[model samples]
Target: MGKKEILVVDDQPGIRMLLTEIFTSQGYRVTTAETGQEALDSLYAGSFDLLMLHYKLPVVDGVQVLEQLEKDQFTIPAIVMSGLSEDIMKESQQFEIVKEVLAKPFNVEEVCEFTRSILE
Candidate 1:
């Protein structure tokens, strides 16, 4: 297979940069968006193997993005990142596309490993 493409949505520039750098180093093609609208645009424009998004965003937020995707019948496995992972985890269970919930300040290695396993 070709390099797995990941769409990472986070309002925080640092978080987006960190994940983009780590995933790129690990041989994944990473695209990032600062708002949920941008993420939705990217999702609608092209194909991606995975999605990683922060729960709190500027306007649309992560859940809104997922809801839109669901409404459009766009299916993609997602990892929801949040400082409040426990709560988001419970809330995200309702979305079948959400395969994982990651807490902020997470280990890069773990993220890489999980992503590798998922794409593999």
Candidate 2:
């Protein structure tokens, strides 16, 4: 079987590059998008086993992107990452499809392990 594919969506180029490098080194297929719209476009073009999304995004916010994905019936698991406060986390957790939320400055290994656990 092929390696699992992960889509990393973040407005920051540094974050995107970091995730791309981390996942690639771990033998997973990694794709990236700098904005929510770009991420959505990438999703429409191909299949991905998971998504790592930054909460605050350009063009469309991460929550909006998640809503759209739900509307479109794309059930891929997602991990939402943000530096937001507890209230935001509570609100985002209302979405059933969202598996987890990781705060910013999180350990890269934790993120990778979470992804692996869910995808496996």
Candidate 3:
């Protein structure tokens, strides 16, 4: 099989760069966007094995993106990342495609392992 693909959305350049480097090292094909609109555009232009996003995104929040994905009938699996409290994180669990909600300040190893598990 070809390398699994991932669309990672985060507004911070440093975080985006970090994730790109990490996922690339893990042998995954990764694309990134700084805004939910850009993510949606990318989604329209291509398909990915998974979607990883931050809850507090610019233009459109993560929840809105999930709503849009649902409306468009895209059921790809997703991982939501945020520094918000667990109670707040629980909100994103409502989406069927969102398989994980990772709290921020998470270990890179954990993230890598989680992605590997999902892509497998």
Candidate 4:
């Protein structure tokens, strides 16, 4: 099979870069979006195996993006990342696509293992 593709969506440039680099190093095809619109655009434009989304964003928040996915009937799996991870986790329980909630200030190895567990 081809390498798994991951879309990393975050308002924070550093997080985006870090995830992109980490995933790329692990032999995945990674794309990044700084906004929810860009993430949705990427989702509509191509195929991705997983989504790593930030809870807080300008204009279109992560929940809004997940709502859009439901509206469009996209079944892509997602991991929601947030400083307020517990709040988002509780709120995101309704979305079947959200497989996990990752807290910010996360461990790099944990991120890798989680991705591997989900995709592999």
What are the TM-scores, per candidate, against the unseen true structure? 0.96, 0.95, 0.95, 0.97
Model 2 spans with C-alpha error above 4 angstroms = none
What tens-digit string does per-residue lDDT give for candidate 1 at 1-120?
788899999998999999999999989899999999999999999999999989998889999998998888878989899999989989999888888889988988889877887788
* Alpha carbon lDDT of each predicted model: 0.91, 0.90, 0.88, 0.94
Total clashing pairs in model 1:
0
What range of 10 consecutive residues in model 4 has the weakest lDDT sum?
Answer: 105-114
Native-to-model Cα distance after best TM-score fit, residue 100 in candidate 3, in Å: 0.7
> lDDT per residue, candidate 2, 1-120, as tens digits?
999999999999899999999999988999999999999999999999999999899899999999999999899898999998366589778776689899998898898889889889
Q: Write the per-residue lDDT of candidate 4 for residues 1-120, one digit (tens) a residue.
A: 999999999999999999999999999999999999999999999999999999998888999999999999999999889999889989999999999899998989989988998998
- Against the true structure, candidate 1 has what lDDT? 0.91
Q: Which should have the higher lDDT, number 1 or number 3?
A: 1
In model 2, what lDDT does residue 88 have?
A: 57
lDDT string for model 3 (72-100, tens) is 99988888889884964678767888888
lDDT of 1 at 65: 94
